[model samples]
Target: METKNINIPAHGSNVLRADIPAEYKWHVQDIYADEAAWQAACAEFKALLPQLEALKGSITSAQGLYNALHLQDKMSQMLDKLYAYPRLQQDADNTDQHLQAIAGEAEALAAAFSSANSFIEPEMLGLGKEKVAAMLAELPELAEYKFYVENLLRITDHILSADKEAIFAQSRLATGTAASAFRSLVSADMEFPPITDGEGKPAIVSEGNYMLNMTSPDRELRKNSFRGLMGTYHKYRNTLATTLTGSARTAYFYASVHNYKDTLESCLAEDNIPTSLYDGLIQTVHDNFAPLHEYIQLKKDVLGYDEFHPYDLYMPLSKAADSFACTFPEACAKVEEALAPLGEDYIATLHKGLTEGWIDIYENKGKRSGAYSWGVYGVHPFVLLNYQQRYSSISTLAHEMGHALHSYYSSMNQTYVNSEYTIFCAEVASTTNENLLLEYTLQRANDEQKIYLLNQFLEAVRTTVYRQVQFAEFEKFIHGEITAGRSLQAEKLENYWLESNRQYYGPALTVDQELASEWSRIPHFYTPFYVYKYATGYSAATAFSSAILSGAPDAVEKYLGFLKAGGSDYSLNILKNAGVDLNTPQPVTVTLQKFA
Candidate 1:
């Protein structure tokens, strides 16, 4: 039977941004009172640029170094406000050319600020280790920046000469074009063929609804959407191949230039992650493939499908069961209930933020898809959502709130330099919220809801854990191939992706030729070695959340400490303090046991 196409029009497709209710929108005005105020602030920030620039070549004394560091921090704080305001405005309605222009100007201003300050690092390194240490001793204020000082001295070899660093700073845009080009292709240029729904209605295939289509109970429609989407990617294989290959090479380029052994090392070094941690994640997933394969087979049995295809992966076994939908207020209330273990203060803060304009809750025309918790140092965290009243949406709400609260706590507790969390730890908080919501719901659910919850958990593990590991492995493979002087041709990438899928999905699923083009669609590939963190973070979160739900003493406290710690410590160290070690496979093993 043909599957009925679900028509959940992406929120931003038809409505005016202004028409969205004020209660449902984010109040960015708190960041800057108005455009005039933002403009005035921008002027002041521009005036301070030369002041920061003047400190270059004069770091011989402690006071001079202290002044430069403080001025730089102040400028950065102002620039965050300047950059975030328009950027959020543009994201609210990307079709607005005025807002887009403003966003562009903000970006350019940031780039210019970065370029102007590029001399600081190189010149500081040039001052020689003895001089820098002596200055630190001479100026006791520098003691607060002890971590910053040691980190700089540690990477002295990677710090380029002033001219080289300046020239390299100017090349950021050109180097980033591959990813930008891929985004434009998929989001703006590529189009999928319309597929008829099971209701005998025509449904447009879009990035927004393609996954929703995949979850259709009707087999034919799922096949159609799958084919339609992947087929489009197949058509643009060459262009995408060039983009992917270029991006992979770009990662290698940056790593080689900086004297790292490979791109993974280069990327992970920012958070002090060792290459063994990355490798251990992949190895652990391989060891735990039994649970994943067993789950896939269970899916086939539950759905009564004699043959399972890649297209059949998303739908639950019982299609006719009652599905979940909640209003925005309902979802918020549920979130508050699910996170009750975290104490009243945490929930109250989240509630205040939600009601007091910290969330942009609905979709409007030209609004960005997906959700995120975004904020600057001096402001409260803001969440962006294209919230549809589905169960996943509730989980998304929880997830983003997880991020928002993490930012809130970190900002309240840490210095500006340390307030921002690394991406490695960032996903942990979000996924932990998801685990809590799942567990809380399961606790009160009937048999039907229990089944649905289990299915949802499995699907989450599959996508975030298995699928992400596949991507990560694919990244490692391509990077290895590229670094070894193998050309990243389209066919080569497709084969690598195909093998990764087969390994991850196992013998129960059919691996088709069209699936080969899947690599072209992942935006993360452009970022290089980033997808692995999703798997690692999700695994770590599952462990942390389970501990908290078990009511272990200090579990919630340790998790909260993890959030507040932010970049104050390296990511693994933060996780270690919170009670999971990614360097070992225990978290991965414990996470998989949940599936078994």
Candidate 2:
């Protein structure tokens, strides 16, 4: 109970959106000139709904299918614009009621539109694959939809009868109850006990600020925050285990109902990713635990700690040094230099977005907490960030900008149907930019900054690559248990979590009991089998980063091809064209060596 004064920043009194400078805020107007314009567009779109219904029965003919597909594409493009504007507006100031209503209207209309067009996929599949291909061959205008149509046909086995599909869709509401309970328990109902911060004032630990405290230089603060945070979760262990078990059961049910062999197969089949890709990543990371152990040992040595624990993992090795912070303009300049290898056109587009209010740069009251790059078709991408001027924040700026530029390229080059990239490729673009920033900064860093940068890079690998795989393994274990007809009771979950952590953390470190309770708090468990993509994506980025840095022939062009390639190809194949093969262990091996 140390009670020394802590100089925590003040909460409350959030700055109004109107009070923020125009340049520092996101340009929501780019989506629509005003609310009145948005209303008119919504009306026009609503009136055009009958046109889609008109083509419902006539899609049997090639020309008719082409017309329907073309019309759907046009409607989607406008619908995206209509939805993106208010959604972004609501995010900017979540406390505003007007924006909330606008967002609701936009979402409801989009959902209705989706329901209205749900017949297209089933009808198109009913026409059979050969007929669809022949129609595609006959209609040049629908050629852009070849891959889309092919994918729908490829998954024809999984698409149930209309009545069965309707039942499954309705059951989704019930299937998701476990996830909803988990979310409610963690976010709304969970309470973290107050912990002492640096200088010893009482501070409350929360999800919003937990990472900040975890990364604090104050040892007691970090230790107490970890304890305080997990203590709350520990109390809910049994309840959470049940909820997680239910979620896993739900995944199994869906897999069984859909005729997939297992939960992992079902999830991968969505992106047309093979099970080998997932298994290869787990096997590779398991084989290469030495780099991770060595990095952990380095942290212990550098931090001068007698024993390393989970709480000690996030503190910077160069804790006594001043934190690196930059102004928004300065961050942009650093990112520009880092992204220099991506070609002038890429840089030019990024520069325009940076200056032209495409980014919401600062954190005021009620602004979004984390960061993301999002936009609909026909408009430039918008990034939401809480820029606090840290050196890592510069990397984050670069990461989101990478996503933004990827969207820019995809939207500019590909049709609306193919403009949105998959999450597998999306993470690659962002992490590639992060790697480039690390390399660029290292080139000019002094000894201290170099050590700091290396430490940061190692941290990135630890969290993104190693930690995510550990999570993936845990996910696999629980889902495997369910598929094998075993129950995921609290004790079973704790044991499995501890075993997974020990395997990754190695014999050099202690696997604390508190850490086993971590599975109770992870949200990804509800989504089952989604964490491995982070590991795979980061490995792919490392490979691409190395290629571009080594000046390999056509490397830049291949990498740019990756950015412009949206949903046109399967995720793994898209990376294959860019020269990184996830099916092999080389990317993971190369990334591990880089960590060394």
Every model's TM-score: 0.93, 0.88
Pairs of colliding residues, candidate 2: none
lDDT of 2 by residue, 59-121 (tens): 798888888788878888889899899878766766677876787687667765765565577
Across 1-596, the per-residue lDDT of candidate 1 in tens digits comes to 11145333435445788777676788989899999998899889889888877887877688888887778878888899898999888778766778867876777778777777888888888889999988898888887666677677877887788777777776775687787677657654576787886776877666666666677787788888888889999999999988888888888887888889888889888777888888888888898898888888888888888898898898886542336675677788888899999888899988887678889887776676678889678889889988876788889999999999999999999888777898888889899999999999999887888888888998998899888888888888888988997768888888888888888888898888889998888877887778888888899998888799889989989988998897887788888988888778787777777777
* The best candidate in terms of TM-score: 1
| Alpha-carbon deviation at 464 in model 2, angstroms | 1.5
Cα deviation in Å at residue 583, candidate 1?
Answer: 2.8
Q: Of the candidates shown, which would achieve the greatest lDDT relative to the real structure? A: 1
Model 2 error, position 185 (Å): 6.5
Worst 10 residues of 2 by lDDT: 1-10
The Cα local distance difference test for each model comes to 0.82, 0.81
